[model samples]
Target: MLYRDGLTREGIVVDVIIVGAGPVGLSLALGLARAGKSVVVLEKDPGLHTTSRAPIIWPRTQEILADLGVMDRFESASIILKQFTMWNADSNHKLISLPISELKDQTHFPQILILPQHKTEALLYEALKAYPSVQVHFAHEVTGLSQDSESVRVRYATNGTSESEMVASYVVGCDGAHSAIRAALGLELDGITYPLMAALADVKLPYNDPNWVFPRLSVKDVPVVAVQIELGEWRLILPFTQDESITMDERVRLSVKNLFHQADYSLIWQSEFKLHQRISPQFALGRVALAGDAAHLNSPVGGQGMNSGIQDGALLCTALVKAIDTRNPALLQPNAEMRHAKINFGVNQFTNILTRVVMLSKGRYMPWVLRILNLVLKIPSLRQKFLMKLTMLGD
Candidate 1:
């Protein structure tokens, strides 16, 4: 159960075998490599995604990127998010606008940045090149995972036919939801999947409004959130209540036009999915740990899922580097415990409440909830506290 001077008894060169090469896994790989740890990334996809998913990067995460030394490059490609506004869809009345500029005194990076998830992943991957110890294997899907007291073993298939094996001191899963690593470890998500089917789309609008996030609350129909991912490219998330439309393309257009009153916009890409407010009871089960969607699934209402995953990756990297350097096997437990508490009670719970609130369109409690929210949001002290939580400045 020892490091054998860096490699395992079977001559495995990697210190950590990271399953999945999304932002979380890549960030962890980059962090470990920067600290002089040998790591490998195994991704099921042939390459990085082309579309924009999970677009908002919070202030706290921006600081983490600065620590990793990519903020300068990231800031160039990303747009600053100015404010988030809530509105009544039925009457088009503005309820509140929370300006992100209010956090100027709290941190150097005061506002959130809007950059697509794919670009973030690519940046993290690019940063790993400075360290020669990192290895990335794409189209290599991890099929089985086994661990002993000393080391963990991973088996993955390349091109879906050829199989190979590798051993490491520790293995981490950033494989995302429906993770093969998590399933091989026999862990349960333990939460609720929303009953309504949700649809998300990225499109080109006729006009430019890149600073605002419009959350349209509806009593007559499902709720919608429309925000610009780039200069003129907006992303929309709403309930999918499709009828007998001839084509999905037509349905997407009809839905957006009905809700946003936009007469002309080109749809770039669209997808339908289900949201789950779920989490694993433990972040790590022995030496094999989980991060990102593999460990937790947020509602996507407040864009917390990817942020939480990136935070998880940074913490895991720090913990494992220390553990490997000092040869302390117990360091991972405390790291996992701290992450569980921080995310379970913080991001996971915060987005869950937001998801439920946005869906309460025609409920009887709407009047009471709005009255209380109006009174509470009027307090500067409370709003500051909320901004702290929303941006996760403390994490």
Candidate 2:
């Protein structure tokens, strides 16, 4: 039932038209469809995202996924991380340890899960298929968007070949950083991109620790970070200097060699990235609203990028369902304001501080800083507070 050249005369109309089928978009569709609302998810890409991007799902996000009825599937496909250890790579000593397992009394899913973004999307897509009222169209690129006093009319291309149109009562942009819906609405994403660039690669390492996740930083010669994603696969992040002389593979190899003193690992995936700390001025504009990366983008230090977006989807859908039922679009304003506040005060601020600490960890004062940090974390109440902030359960 895919629409090719424009919609039929008696064409299809839905309660909500969601642009982008990423985790945020898909999560929102699942919530809206389950609430008995007709939903249509439009994705420009032909299939699921395969990259190992955004691998950590915090406890708060796990709670939301549980409400979506897909936690069991995630539990089977992912690995739970009970503890996070930050090491002084130069000295080869542990700087601080955050025990995530101790939070069991505060939450049902007490630990963070290391599941790749692609698998998480697959589970959500499968769950979405059970709803007859929900329709997902792939290779459909949104080209134009306009809204009248009542509904929104979206113009798109099917596989970049033909044009089509679909109208809906509301439209949401869950697209990534370069969101078409956000651009079409003439809104600006304001923030600064850090001068530093990060090189990320997934590799099979010789280290075989299972329950603990390592954040090895402050190596002697190289400034980089490494974290274990699964059993044998690890993700490494280093500053990308854009030196045209050295190949990306060489940079990754050198970083790994410098940190681990071993050259026996195999590369799985690699990419260079520039970090940005930005957020849109407003989350809602008339009948069109933005969520996920479209609404905000922050440092990946705390693994809050995907988690915050999932939270956005869950909260926005609840407000949208009520607004649709009550015939009052103003009900969505509260959600927009609340999400904006959380991103600004909670995610952005926290991650910014973390990025700074990691960047400065190799400085002369880092040893003293680590000692003080270790002492603070030894306090049970303070450690629990830190855990709540990292897990997003504090909100």
Candidate 3:
């Protein structure tokens, strides 16, 4: 029962204090509350964002969401994507339509789900109502944190003015890349930011294709991704050069025209991003832990960042409860190790290579890569192995 206005803050310690009320944080809070742990969520924002930041929910993520018992709402509201087509702009032909059916045996959700990140956050917020043990405080920015063997102390502003204090048996930072908690812990982010910049736009257009997610790569230029978020609204993720100086709106308009061959479109919401593939040296630094972009970052090319963050929350939920219940802090170590290893050698590395590979459409070896991809799609065995990597079910 979270009211939008104000949260009741008694000076009492809770089981877990989660930073950031985005999907990852909220997902962790939900699982903790369902397990009967007292959970408090601290969010800097006033409410759920109006923009669509991350829109694609891969099959594995859908399975996690389904386990939370809220997939029906998302399935009813979003467009279920069955195919991903990579196009060869140089040859003016599609290289391959990815085989999602091959994942049918791996997961019950064998398809990708598309919905704005805000809507997903809202649903997670609403679902938290069923658990009375959870309290979500909006517009509360954490300023400082400290822990000593037993409980962690968190200091934050109630609404950006008055200072408030609370304590928790454990705390996890689900904040983004610029995490205050990560900074307070003095953890170093050990990775690199990619050279390419990306722009995402939510717009209304006459074009409609809900069955497929398309990314067109030019042997002479960078690639472009087009996805229909809903029946009338499309989310276009277009990359720009590092030195490009065009207005974001103009970029959105030009991308719509270039990709869909349609000039009549209205840009509603948009955001610009400098892509990065980075990971922290450690996820759990003592009683404080980092999740989501706070712990790791990957290219948006594979749509793995948010999905991985949600997976982090899901994995952390169980570990946190167990560690708190058993009074064994060492139980938390394995989760941090697993998260770091799976991403560093797995998603982070793969997406780092993928972000570079896509941008190198004009590179010398891109055509040969595309040729090999075509060959892979033709054979079921090879295609299934490829789909395992693409859908992340293999992880």
Candidate 4:
């Protein structure tokens, strides 16, 4: 479909050009294309089937997918999550629970959906494939960008050989952690990186349970949380499993072979992820805007990573559509500022809450502290309120 009929670069063209084909970028591309904007998506990876980054999709993210007209496609591929179990490592005491049912009536998709992030991206890519004006170029990387008063020039290279160009009225950076667009803009990101590198491994559970369950452990060895998924698969995120924790290098393999006793299933993929809490000082730099991980990143606690990023994409797309229609950048400016404020506040609150929960094993008086914590969870009203926030039902 190359327009090689002596057609040369003439006028300022293209409604928008997006960099990155991850979930955030793909979702934004679909949203903009549906709004009648021509979009070009540049992805460095030529194909999919690489990593299983985030496995749990929160309830709120389900709502955003529903609005995009492809909720059923995703729902068919994942399982529903409802219950959680927390157990003491040394003691037999355990807490098992489910999210409040009161939220079922509040939204179209009322339950948590558990699916791999790779699958999520595949579904969105499939939907976007039907759009005539939307083009996804694989192995294409943005090399340089220059902005003038009227338009932005994007230079890209394919497979590090062939070169091409595109002129976009506006550009969106969803390129992920090391975004070229963000770096070119000279944005400063300031935050703290925790020392403990979290280990995530997907394994099939030996036991069978019909319901969704999350196991929280306060064992003498290390703190752990187990999340159940469909098809006998489960995700384990725990501190070092041994009393004398091994180095970060051997944690994943050793934990799977000995600590977790989950060597039956294929190891699949493993990583030592740093829990980062950071956000861009500013989300929008002139006509270039940032969303998803490009804008902020936080701990995967409470399954807030992708949900928050999707919310940012939805809001940014809606704002961009409005701005394009009115031919005014001001309309999109507020979108970046307002969403950045909300995301900053939310990330801080979420990080603080997760830090406290995971650090519950720190206090010297372990047994006595556990008793008090159980007492608070025993209160009907108190438990209900806390569960709402923990399940992301609360504002």
Model 1, 1-395: lDDT tens digits are 11335343575657889999998999888888778888888998999878889998998888889888889988988977666566654566776667778888888788778898888888888888777788888899999988887888899999899888888888999999988888988887988987656778888878654323464444343345566677777777655434333345665565466446667888998888888888888888777889989998888877878998998899888889988887675888999999888888899888878768856742334434655676697799888888788888854
Candidate no. 1 TM-score: 0.88
1-395, model 3: which lDDT tens digit per residue?
22222223333368789999988999889888878788889999998777788888888888888888888988987877677776654566777677586677788988878888888899999999998878898999999998887768999997889987888778999988889999989996888887777777788977655433465554343344566666778777767645466666666666666556568888788777888888899999778899998999889878888898998888888899899778777778888998889888878876877787767753435656777777767888878876787787876
**Residue by residue across 143-206, what tens digits does model 2's lDDT show?**
9899876778899999999998988878999988999888998888898887666778888877
Q: Worst 10-residue stretch by lDDT in candidate 4?
A: 1-10
Cα-based lDDT for every prediction:
0.78, 0.83, 0.79, 0.70
With candidate 4 superimposed using the best TM-score fit, by how many Å does residue 28's alpha carbon deviate from the native? 1.2
Q: Which residue runs of candidate 2 sit more than 4 Å off their true CA positions?
A: 1-12, 87-92, 206-218, 240-247, 258-261, 362-371
What is the Cα root-mean-square deviation between model 4 and the actual structure?
A: 3.8
- C-alpha positional error of residue 240 in candidate 3 after TM-score superposition, expressed in Å: 3.3
Per TM-score, the best of the predicted structures is 2
- Model 3, stretches more than 4 Å misplaced? 1-12, 86-93, 206-223, 243-249, 363-372
Q: Point out the higher-scoring one by TM-score: 2 or 3.
A: 2
Give model 3's TM-score versus the native structure.
0.90
> Candidate 3: minimum summed lDDT over ten consecutive residues — where?
1-10
Candidate 1 differs from the real structure by a C-alpha RMSD in angstroms, to one decimal, of 3.6
Pairwise lDDT winner, candidates 1 and 2: 2
The number of the candidate with the highest lDDT is 2
